[model samples]
Target: MDQYKYIVVEGNIGSGKTSLAKMISQEHDRELILEEFADNTFLPQFYNQPERYAFPLELSFLAARYHQLKKKLTALPLKTFVSDYLFDKSLLFAKVNLKEEEFGLYRTFFELLERDIPKPDLIIYLDKDIAKLQANIEKRGRPFEKDISNTYLENIQIGYEKILSDSGLNVLKINSGELDFVKNESHFKKVINRILTY
Candidate 1:
């Protein structure tokens, strides 16, 4: 925690990044930066009809993230920052879910926007099997997420794997199929130890 200034935990929908990020922040006594997914106006619509709302949803997130990071940079030093999501991964999900033409345009805009942002010092990527991811999503009981399909989750998992593999960033991959760090203190402590030791 002292050596690394910024840490990020990344994963697909219902992959438990937020929970892990919260745990890490508490363990290290660092400030937390959670994504405001519930505030996304297009999120529910995007989930219901991805083709129609994908670009708008992605764009909203990109802008929100950019503004949040900018504010953090201006207000705080980068010595103890932990975020649940990476800015670039927003584009990854968008590209994977959007149509070809929409994706092309989105990528062009993303390239233009990403240059202004600072990258995280490390990324902890949680990879869960599709079934587990779907199960977790259901357990969370988000009204908008109820209609998500297994195929969509599968595509997102593939996208995350490909990005993390070639990211040119330090990544710690965790098998998250059965890791319930939130309610289980011992398992959470074990994971925290690994993160600190690394």
Candidate 2:
């Protein structure tokens, strides 16, 4: 994290990536770019009927993330940046949730818009157990996330791990189950130290 100017915090739902990204931005006093998933009108339906709604939901996210990244790439200098979502990760969800025919159209649009986006300098992939992820998702109480099954979440978790494994990013793997960085200052400090030394 020392020389990195762009940092992307990535994880499955309720893995605390947004909370951690906010903390990093405040700690370093840098710019924070977060995902506005709740703003998507299709997200709730997508969560409830993934097979039917996956394409539109993923496409909406891709469009929004593309626009956000395009603006950031033009305006933000090579200073520190913490983003809750990575642009390419949109495809991860699309491929996982959408049918082959659906993903075909989704990929076409994604590639068209992603041509000019800046890649992250580092990606922090937060890891967590399925049960812990479900518990956290339940506690957060997003209306759309209410019916999220452990099985669906587990599929997403597996997809995330696979993506991170293949990505040549400066990835810092954190076990969210063990580290309650939100409430534990000392633990959070330790994580910061680790990131600083990375």
Candidate 3:
């Protein structure tokens, strides 16, 4: 864990990536970087009508992620940093949500922005079943997220699998279907130990 200057905790929606990232950052005394998804006004609209708002939603997210990563990575002192998302998450979600032609155009912008961003040294992926993910989503009780169908979650999971398989980054995938690291201290300790031993 100390060898990794930048670590990314990735997972499907409601998989508790943000929570795990926060815990890691605090425990390790690393700087934390979280995705600002709530700031995007197009999110709720995209959920309500995906086809109508998919392109703009993805585009907005891409630009926002690029700017946020660039600013934070550039300004921060050289030290360990834990982020809840990978920079390529924009591409993963775009590929899932956009049409073929729209994706082609989105990829063009994505590739250009990606070249300037820093990559993570290690990626900690929280792997959870769709059932667990849905249950967690419901527990969170966000109105915009209430309508997230199983099919959509499955697609996102598949997208993540495809991207991660070819990413060439050092990745540690954890089976989190039964783990409640937030409330269970043992589970959290296990996660930390896995990172340290990996």
Tens digit of lDDT per residue, candidate 1, span 1-198? 577788899998898999999988888887789988888989989878888898899888888988887677557874588899988887778877788898888888888888877888889888888888888989999999898888878888888888888878888888877788998998788777777788
What is candidate 2's lDDT per residue for 1-198, written digit by digit as tens? Answer: 558888899998888999999999998887899998778999888877777788778888898998888888678676678999988888888988889998898889888887788888888888889888888988988888888888888888888888788877678887777888899999789878878887
- In model 1, the runs with Cα more than 4 Å from the true position are none
Comparing 1 with 3 on lDDT, the higher-scoring candidate is 3
> What lDDT does the true structure give each of the candidates?
0.85, 0.85, 0.94
Q: List the residue pairs that clash in candidate 3.
A: none
- Shift of residue 185 alpha carbon in model 2, Å: 0.4
- List the candidate numbers ranked by lDDT, top first: 3, 2, 1
**Cα lDDT for residue 101, candidate 3:** 99
Number of the top lDDT candidate: 3
Ten-residue region with minimum lDDT total, candidate 1: 70-79
Give me the runs in candidate 2 sitting further than 4 Å from their true place.
none
On a 0 to 100 scale, what is the lDDT of residue 174 in model 1? 81
* TM-score for all models, in order of appearance: 0.94, 0.95, 0.98
User: What's the distance in Å from true for residue 48, model 2?
Assistant: 2.6
Q: Residue 63 in model 1: shift from native, Å?
A: 0.7
- Strongest candidate by TM-score: 3
